[model samples]
Target: MIITKAKPIEEILPFLEGKERIFLVGCNVCAAKMKTGGEPEVLALFDYLTGLDYNVIGWAVPTAACSVRSYESLVEKNEKLKEADCVLVMACGSGTSVIASILDLPVTGTNDTLSLGGQIGSSAINHLCSLCGDCNIGDYSGICPNACCPKSQINGPCGGSKNGMCEVSKTSECVWYIIEKRMKTVQTLPILNKIKPPKDHFV
Candidate 1:
């Protein structure tokens, strides 16, 4: 599931302030279950706007607004959307782009699109290893130092490592600790003794 956060209603109102006809487009894909762009969220936003005395002409929720085929039906039903001042999309960035391509109306994002993962516990994502394109975990026994390291070092641990904890924060797990554990498990602890050159910051 793609994680997302809703934009504030105050942030969304300026676009439709003076417009007589406005449409609030919600997505049933990512934002629905996440409660960011579902029917309930849209209705709540519509009610807020009506309370503020803004003319909200109509609203609709389409299944997977990012899908080109799904948007075709939305376009059919909301032909009047063409006449709308703006189309406020509550989908991810990609979905907003898809909606803009099919509709001539100006598109605005109502959700802050986050990473393509689900929540694990405490509203935080688990195993958030942002694959930064260059991977060099083969020597480290498949453990990502880029993610585990507090400084995001790919070579060896910095001078600030203290008792298997990062110097930046005590909460962070040291990358070298994880690397050493992996090496020992694989019976390749001897590899840790080898000197690793400084990582190229550009790469």
Candidate 2:
């Protein structure tokens, strides 16, 4: 899941200021869960825009705004969008980009793309999981060293690790502590002896 927040209403109002018809598009995937640009949010926007004297023609919530299939369905269902003065995309930057590529009308982003991680709790906390396009967590005892370590070291605990905590902060748990415990449970502590080379930035 990607986390996003809606742009200020003041900034967004200018685009549809003099426009007669506006289409408020919502993404049902990430933005929906984040409470940014979901169906309810779009409806609220429509009401506000309509109250501002702009003619809000209609609104739609696509299953996944970034998906080509979902985008096609939205385009087919909302034929009125063609006549709209502009399309306000209440989705991540990628979703808005997709809308722009397919639509001739002016497309605007109502949200800012934050991260590619999912929700942790009440707050949409995301771990810095670097999707390097290749995963090596299996060799690393199911631990994502890329995100676990501040320095992103893959071999073993850094010199900064103290009492199973990171030197950066006492609240920060040491990634190597987690790796060691996991390796010990599986009797694979010998793997830690193997030194790993520095990460290839291009990779």
Candidate 3:
């Protein structure tokens, strides 16, 4: 799932400065799961904007605002959207961009895209994969050194890690250290001996 954080009101105010007849679009998937742009959130924002003397024409929480077809369907079904002079999308950057591309009016996002991560108990965790096109996590006990390591070290630790912590960020544990420990626990430490080819950044 894509992780996202809601933008503060101070930042969102600027986008609505001279705009009236606003329409809000929220996502029921990633944004909803994060409690950023769910149905309740969109309605609360609608009331807040109304109290501030802004004419909030309508609001909709689509199944997935990132989908062009879903958003287009909502737009076609809701005639009030045609009256909107501005659109405030409470989804990720991709959803906002897709809406903006489909609409002639000004479109803005109310959330900041954090990362392509997943939900873990009540928190979100960033994945080790950076989507580098060449996946080799299977060779390293399902951990990708390209993303977890600050230096993107694929072969092994840079020898700068001490006490299992990274030299670059003393507070964060070295991913290589975690990988090694995990491999040891699984009795697969010998797999680390295989040389990994350098990542093809162009991919």
Candidate 4:
């Protein structure tokens, strides 16, 4: 799932200083589930802006805000978006880009889109994919350092690891330790012998 968090209202207010008519957009898939850009959050922003004495034209929470087709349909239906002075997108980075591409108005964001992550349950999640495009999961028995490690260490720990914890974060564990333990349990340590080459930055 794509992780996202709401930007502080204080930080967002600066963008609306001179603007009057505002159009709000939200995402219904990733941000909706994350509670950052869903309809409820959009409505809350609408009220907040109303309290601040801005004319809110309209708001739409697209089912998939990252889809060009979905966002186009929303703009076509609202029409207020065309008249508004600017648009505020309360979605992930991908979704925000989609809205900006399909609109002629000034576009702004209200959420910080985070990494692609894995969900352990309904609420708990952890970063799972860094989208490096190299995909070395086969080398480490499906574990990926790019996703779990702070330094994006490809080979092993930096020797700062102590008591199975990462050098940077006390709450986070050393990814190499997890990889080593998994390899030993499955007797797949031999796979690590085929070291990964340097990642191609061009890709």
Q: Pick the candidate with the highest TM-score.
A: 4
Q: What lDDT score is found at residue 94 in candidate 3?
A: 88
What 10-residue stretch in candidate 2 is worst by lDDT?
A: 125-134
Candidate 1 Cα lDDT to native: 0.75
lDDT (Cα, tens digit) per residue for candidate 2, span 1-203? 88788888888877776667788889998899998888899999888877878888888888878885644567698888767878899999989998888877888999987656666676675544666655677777777787667777788777988889987657988888888899899988897777766666676
Model 3 Cα lDDT, one tens digit per residue, 13-97: 8899889799999999989988889999999999999999999999888788888674457777678998999999999998888
Residue 18 in candidate 4 has what lDDT?
A: 88
Over 4 Å off, model 2: 10-20, 70-72, 119-125, 148-190, 201-203
Which candidate leads the pack in lDDT?
3
How far residue 190's Cα lies from its native spot in candidate 1, in Å, is: 8.9
- For each candidate, what TM-score against the reference? 0.68, 0.73, 0.87, 0.93
Model 1 lowest lDDT segment of ten: 121-130
Model 1's C-alpha root-mean-square deviation from the true structure amounts to 4.4
Candidate 1 displacement at residue 41 in angstroms: 0.9
Query: How would you encode candidate 1's per-residue C-alpha lDDT over 119-194 as one tens digit per residue?
Result: 5553644233545666666778877676556577766778988898888777877878878888989987787676
lDDT of 4 by residue, 55-163 (tens): 8989988887888685458767787887788889998889889898888778888998778875666873667788888887878888888888998888888889998
In TM-score terms, candidate 2 sits at: 0.73
Clash pairs, candidate 4, are none
Given candidate 2, what's the lDDT at residue 68?
53
